[model samples]
Target: MRGQSYVILAIIFVIIVAIFAVINVDPVEVNYLFGTGEAPLILVILFSVLMGGIITAAVGLVKMIHLQREQKSLQAENKQLKETAGENQLIDDDNNQENPDGKKNL
Candidate 1:
């Protein structure tokens, strides 16, 4: 199912690109800091879109890594807390079994 969804999405993307390319067939001159070149308007648009996607993905990847680290730390802290609570509970039970004379009863 995931593969099928990817295929459908790819088809839709290709159709949209094709429509954009057909509509923007004129060649445009692009001037950069070092040089200048002529490229089709569609290519420019596609390049811009690809660069934006790359940047967004990079930012999202960084955020995901940070969140994963946070999650791992939180999980470790939670386990530690549980263990401490269990130990405290056992000590509480033991103390409750004793009387106020500071000696074990029964």
Candidate 2:
């Protein structure tokens, strides 16, 4: 499972990089404040990609949290079932007559 995930992740990364490269848009430069210059095209594209990744991660995180809550609820229910079964077993045991001296009452 882990290997497959790694392979898939690599493929996705390759696809993204290839897409960016294929577009081949020229990098734009911008000046701000006091004589500071920046490349507009690359910066904007990179920031957009980063934001998209962050949004995707947040969605995944929410899903994981929901699944964890469900798992906890199931575990609690299972424990309750086990306890009830044990209690029933004890009641059944008490109904069976047994002599205190390691023998049956019959």
Candidate 3:
């Protein structure tokens, strides 16, 4: 099933991250604009990955919201067009009935 595939992929991802963390255990100095500190290399890598994922998700969310708004606007426009078409059809039917002789009114 699709759900099973996702579960398998998640397990594989966890194993990969675990292997990465175990292989990178050395402490290293981290520098920032205002301060500096020492942290395990694995922690720094994990933090960077987490921040990247957050940023990527934020960007995707913004795009999804924009698309949803556009979809709603399109749906409203479609509904309006359908209503106008229905009104025109009704008027044409009335005109045809009044002109059963099949001649122009003008």
TM-score leaderboard ranking: 3, 1, 2
lDDT to native, each model: 0.90, 0.80, 0.90
Give model 2's TM-score versus the native structure. Answer: 0.61
RMSD of each: 4.1, 6.2, 2.5
lDDT of 1 by residue, 1-106 (tens): 9999989997898789778877997999999999999999999988887898699999999999999999999999999999999999988887679677877755
lDDT winner? 1
- Candidate 1 achieves a global lDDT of 0.90
Q: List the residue pairs that clash in candidate 1.
A: none
Query: How many steric overlaps are in each model, in order?
Result: 0, 1, 0
Clashes of 3: 0
| Ordering by lDDT | 1, 3, 2
Q: Write one digit per residue (lDDT tens) for candidate 3, span 40-82.
A: 9999988887898799999999999999999999999999999
Q: List the candidates' TM-scores in order.
A: 0.75, 0.61, 0.81
TM-score of 1: 0.75
